[model samples]
Target: MPAHRYSELHTIPFYECNVNNRISIPMLINILILASEHQNEKLGVDQLYLIDKYGIGWVVTSYSIHITELPRKDSVVKMTTRGTSYNRYFAFREFWLHDQDGNELVKVESIWVLMNEKTRKITAIDDDVITPYQSEKVRRVPRLPRPGRIEPEDQMTSKEYQVRWSDIDFNGHVNNSRYPEWMLDSLPMDFLDTHEPTNIDIRFENEVKYGNRVTSSVVVDSSDNDKIKTVHEIKSSDVLSASATIVWKENKAEGQD
Candidate 1:
């Protein structure tokens, strides 16, 4: 069968950039998510369709993104996405970003699961549902390295965050992209100013709904401070909502990191 894919062009807006004037990691994630939504809409299996027809919604289980070059503000870029494969309860997707000249800048891989809206339990993906995307069924989907386990003693700092209405997505839960924002915010301002993230791997363990208070905890590697791992759980709660490992590189002069 022919590969099913979707592609679109986007201009980097000023709000999406950080102090360095390059596209921020969270914004990159949002763009890739939008691309996936667009593709699903074309295939008639989008959020609205699934929620209305199947009483289910898509929840991202994990994501891994590798950035070769960060797109600068005001630059136009093309993003493409496609459904790779699926099995039982899980589906895989891939995303790519390119410059105007078609030079690849970034690649992302993600895993998603179907959740029953009423029961709040994971449900098996229907063949009729995934068939529209033409995603093949695979024994094992492609994945990136899982985020490292965070030990209790390694916890450095923790901050509590109240989920705002703005953070909620159509599924009535905190958007997946928002987790990166929360994780990055837990870092000191100086660390953020001095270093930039090159690669990020995140795993979502549970859903965080609006009005939930979550605490983001950071754990820096003892051997290398540049490698930071964080875990976020609902405040005063034991449920682990998400965990991420971000590799940072010191920023250099003239837009290099």
Candidate 2:
């Protein structure tokens, strides 16, 4: 079977960058999703097509991203995505972001499940769906480092946010990319300024609908002063909606400590 990777070029706009002028994690995810969608469209299996033809849609179950560097505003980067493999109920996808000079800036792996749009039930992935992507069934899919479970004692800070209409996707729920934004916003600005996220792992537990409110909680682990580990939870009406873990490294310029 031929390889099925797809690539797209993007320019990091000013609005996608944070105050520090680096691309925000949430925006990076959005770019990756866009790349994946473009590839799916080429394969005739994009979300809209799936929902229309099969009454099913792809829903992300978990994701892990490793960041080597974040592109600065106005920087040109290439984003690529491909289907790695699949099983009866799950599909594995991989994404990468490369700088103009061909250095990899970000790598991500995600697990997705096909859900029946009308019944909202998990569905088996059809062979025809996987065939176009040239993906094979794998006996064991590679797993990323799992995010630590949150404990009662670890809850350090919490903030509540209302889901806006704009946050709602075609599926009538808050977009998966928005969870990371909510999680990151719960952190102190000082910490965001002093550190940059190097790794992130997130699991989606429940869906948050439009007009619902989500409370994001943050727990910090200071075992290593140089490296910070933060655990996050997004709760809706006191029920867990999603959870995440983010690892950070001190923000320093090239050749600086």
Candidate 3:
């Protein structure tokens, strides 16, 4: 079956933007995620329906994102998403953000799996549960590139964060969008203000529960003048929960552009 696409227009809110007046990465991800959830609702497969019917909910496993530029605060943009395909265990989805003139600003490819809410374990995706999206079914699972790991030789810095109640989503775990925020928070403010991520690759390994104190470790490499790379790992009690690598480019000064 052909894939179904859903799209919406969004005005980037002030709260979602960073000090540079561009939409922040984590909130931008949240917006894209909401678009997908909205699509599922339209397909009669929303989270409430899934959990109530099959005791399962959608969990994101990984995301690969590329950015041409970030939309500024109060800017109207079009966000589009679709379920590309699915296998026995994994589903592939795509998302895109375009400016007012239809110029592509960001593109993302993501992988998702069904998790049993009670067991907190991966559940086999039942045909009926996913067929509503009209995604193609295939026997072979798709392989997404894994995020780069932190190297033993790399110098690292760490930050601790307490998972607040607000961070929990309907899935009862730390929202996937918050993972990036935690990872990014480990960086220096000067770096964040001057650099903007151009590419980000992140993978979630374990679910973090409320009240858990998670540690984010990061290693930044600025050897290349053109682009800076940062590798990150998030752990709770030394158990790896997530990891990511982000490539950034220095932004021009506020008034220069």
Tens digits of per-residue lDDT for model 3, 128-246: 98888888888765676788888788899999999999999866789888899999999999889888999999999988999999999999988988889999999999899999989
lDDT digits (tens) for residues 189-241 of candidate 1: 88888777778888888888888888887776637564543443323276788
| Whole-model lDDT, model 2 | 0.89
lDDT of each: 0.82, 0.89, 0.91
Give the candidate order by descending lDDT.
3, 2, 1
Candidate 1 weakest lDDT stretch, 10 residues: 227-236
| lDDT, residue 36, model 2 | 87
Clashing pairs in 3: none
Candidate 2, 8-46: lDDT as tens digits: 999999999988888988899888989988898999888
- Distance from true location, Cα of 248 in model 1, Å: 1.2
| lDDT leader | 3
lDDT of 3 at 141: 54
Candidate scoring better on lDDT of 2 and 3: 3
